[model samples]
Target: MDLDLKCKTPILSYSDDEFKQILEIRGKTLEQLPEDVNIIKEWLKMQPHLPMHPTDRQIVCFLIMNKFSIERTKEKIDANYTIKGLMPELFSKSPLHPDVQKTISLVSCGFMPKLNKKLNRVYVCRLESTDVVLLDGYNYFCSFLEMKTICDFSDSDEYIFDFSYFPMKMVTKFNPMDFKRVLTLVEKVYSNRIAGLHYVNIPSYAEAMINLIISFLKPKIRERVRIHKSLETLGEFFEKDQIPKEFGGTGISLSEICDNMNVLSKEYDEYIKESNNARVDESLRPTKLINDDFLGYHGNFKKLQVD
Candidate 1:
């Protein structure tokens, strides 16, 4: 089997028919939720129907976009780049379900809460560490054997319960591995939302995408090529013996590794260049220090001081 990069292009090309299918599946799940369920009933009564709400579709598409070809996504981002930098402000507090309001308050003052074009309510949060965006249209109201339970703002058991009633067709095409990843992402997002952090910065989105591709291409390769590719990077943490001064790995240094893996490194570089429509050069690679400003620190929260 040709282990090709799955991200040759962004998967933002879903057809209108496919979008309709997505909505139908989403709406089906939304409607099947118990009518007596506090927030569910309220949400359903207020919103129009599936496919009508673009935010939900955008969330789903964003996840799908993560799986798209890096080159393709880069082209799209470059063409309409400004929009990408400004993280979509979907996570808001005011119009939220009381339960959601309380949950998010546990972590943050919350940002950007907008109405879906169809005017449905959905909460969006970005995880800076992971470059992951989370969407929550279903508010957090739980039911026990006999009673209903509203999640407290401080409760941190953030998780994405299976919307089991959703039509199976909606997920039949998704890989099992992807399903697990999506679920984990959703739960993490919920946790962050409640905690009020924008996101957790692991590898930046670019590095993560590159690393994901490397992992996809060579499932067994363990090296972190997803990071900078050079001697300078490796030397910072390692010593002449090629052992990490801090740890024990030989500080042989990344400069040495660059020599050893020049070809593979070039491949990664070329891929990035092609994505951004830039000439293939070391300068174009995404090896700069991670920018902290966009890492989701909403800055100091000081209400105006009235003299």
Candidate 2:
């Protein structure tokens, strides 16, 4: 099947300076990492079962993630494909069933239509229901991951996680194992893509929850996670006019943005299904055992250190 890897979402309009900066990064990456394309081609040659033909943008994403270090890029590329292959339930394509749709509707997560002043795409996530477990939060979370394929354009994307309505009970429902999966995907696969993660309207107990999540993250990523006391504090990173009205900004509502995303999700369903073929086939791989431990944690969640 011919996979359409084209970004379906409207590309963020960058300022002259931002555009120039992007070009400089891309040019430098190409110069420093000239063998990047050939590296992927050679890797693909080994994985006969994997049906992916990565685009220039996709290859560049890994390059930028590793700061143009060819060795690190190759390592990341290998880990990324391996994880996708191993965890088909999480990474593979499945129909966006009604249950998934219901979860998505409850958990409003999507990229804001507009870019911040720094030309970074802002991603907004809010949980409307405190019964996160019943909401099938894992699959709901996966929907945002799927959306990122099309929405993630800039080298650095800003994240706004609204926890105003999130209660302590709901926080407990979040499985540490699932949290580990998210961190692994972001750190290992989607590295350097996140500019900053702003947690606004944080509940008093949210700090503990935040700490638990950050413990799974790398130091660099942990540093980027900022807790905002109010929307005013968040405004330091994003303009008030650009923010959605739900978050005390003058822009559109979160529901409206999510509505748009829902439409896009339906349209891109085919692409998501086709992309599953891109996962590496470990059976055919020469390297039989890569470090499959995504977060390096084992045993029951209760035993895991949350503090």
Candidate 3:
């Protein structure tokens, strides 16, 4: 029987009263129809193998009325039910095709159809060794996947403390006042350390708070502010990511340090208004003003000469 397994077998034609109603209704042995599937592995192949093609039986009966088990395919044939009977009203109205929402997030555990943005709904659940069920009840995707798996095991040492000194350790951990308050304290320290500060001794406390805010802004810009050659050229360009956040630029030349701190705060407010007008013209001098009769002329006008 080896003419390549008799030309890869699949040739049944039967019709003698449909093989006598399949040998009087019960006993069956026809087989060979399974192989079709390919509309990109029946919608993106992440563990597909179900009964599949008969034009994907209304998407495998809307993934078995959204329960998602799959692996039958013997050929029962007969259940169009228009889009599997409007899949509970098409997932309760709208947004499916991201390959039928990742085949309803790979049949339920490795779930991904999110869109919850405050209950807008596509129902979120299933990703923890997945079993494929989330049609609307995995309690907000297993409490946001166990809060992102305990925030990825508490930031497994903060992305190895290297986001090019994440905007200079978030503008020296909020020592903000300008440079647009250090870019709003680097967007609230990278959105609260990528949402819930896990850990890795926070990049040596973000490299000693960005080396104390770039050595306190190079000694307030050089009045003998010897910042050891601008903190060793911004600590070797913040350890080689090339600086710019306004001279400390990681997000590069951060608006030239807010235009050099608004042109050095308008030249330190015109040098404190010309040093308070030269200390009021060297402590200004003034003479006394005479009053009344001038004390009847000093010693009676040198003894009675009526001047």
Candidate 4:
């Protein structure tokens, strides 16, 4: 299936009625898109700390991801820039930096071209080689998330993490502290309200590590995590055809999906370059800001200044 990459809007597969129903469920409508976007634009003008002016489409996406809560949308936008401004190790790099490109070769990860019944985007990630580096993998994910946050339109996302070839010795490959940082950035910065976190083909040795990761999730989200022993079980939530062919579904192969992702990254390269500079100026922040909790640092915003 072709990912409608030519358009500046979401990859259009949903019929108008279905799309409207999804919007209505979130207390939003196509009619309110422009008005709500304008409201956010006006709000941005008042925040001296934030420098970026996002597109109308990005604003609408933030609104949907936040369930149409304008207040939450504003907070998400602020955190999006604030965290990026503070963490150069992850966010400040170019989307297609060498490490990120190397990660594409090391792992197979991509978003499904179509939305699930709940209209949440589906993502599948698999390790291809035991030569996995957590930092590189995260950089790849960050690049992908950044591009999606700006370019794709989706309210929420569900992830299928395939640990098929993952080595048992590296169960501790990703530190718990690093995991927390990544979790906060995705949930707070991009407003990625996760619908489900499904794990398939988990090795016996990795149970403790998986549990540690789950411990970091909010209770509601933790309840949504499922450890699958059988691929058929996933059918309870995802459509049979949409599941990647690697797992017995008739849908697009994960490799092909990654190819689409590569195309997507290229298409948005210029946009990422321009927006990476869009960050919060801590000096101008109107309220008291303490980042003692972000990425495990204890200090005022000025102490952790990245830009």
Best by lDDT: 4
Select the stronger candidate by lDDT from 2 and 3: 2
Question: lDDT by residue for model 2 over 168-237, one digit each (tens)?
Answer: 8876786777677655666666564777888888787767877877777768778888988877777777
lDDT of each: 0.25, 0.63, 0.24, 0.73
Query: Residue by residue across 24-100, what tens digits does model 1's lDDT show?
Result: 54352333322213322233244332112222222223222322223332322221212112212222211233533
Q: Give candidate 4 regions above 4 Å deviation.
A: 1-15, 289-299, 302-307
| Per-model TM values vs. the true structure | 0.17, 0.78, 0.14, 0.88
Instruction: State the lDDT of candidate 4 residue by residue for 120-141, as single tens digits.
Output: 7888988897676677677567
Q: What are the root-mean-square deviations of the candidates from the true structure over C-alphas?
A: 24.4, 4.9, 36.8, 4.4
* lDDT at 263, model 2: 72
Q: In model 4, where is the ten-residue run with the lowest total lDDT?
A: 1-10
Give candidate 1 misplaced runs (Cα > 4 Å).
1-85, 89-155, 172-307
Give the C-alpha miss distance for residue 130 in model 2, angstroms: 2.6
lDDT of 3: 0.24
lDDT of 2 at 250: 85
- Give model 1's TM-score versus the native structure: 0.17
Model 1 Cα shift for residue 88 (angstroms): 2.1
Judged by lDDT against the true structure, how good is candidate 1? 0.25
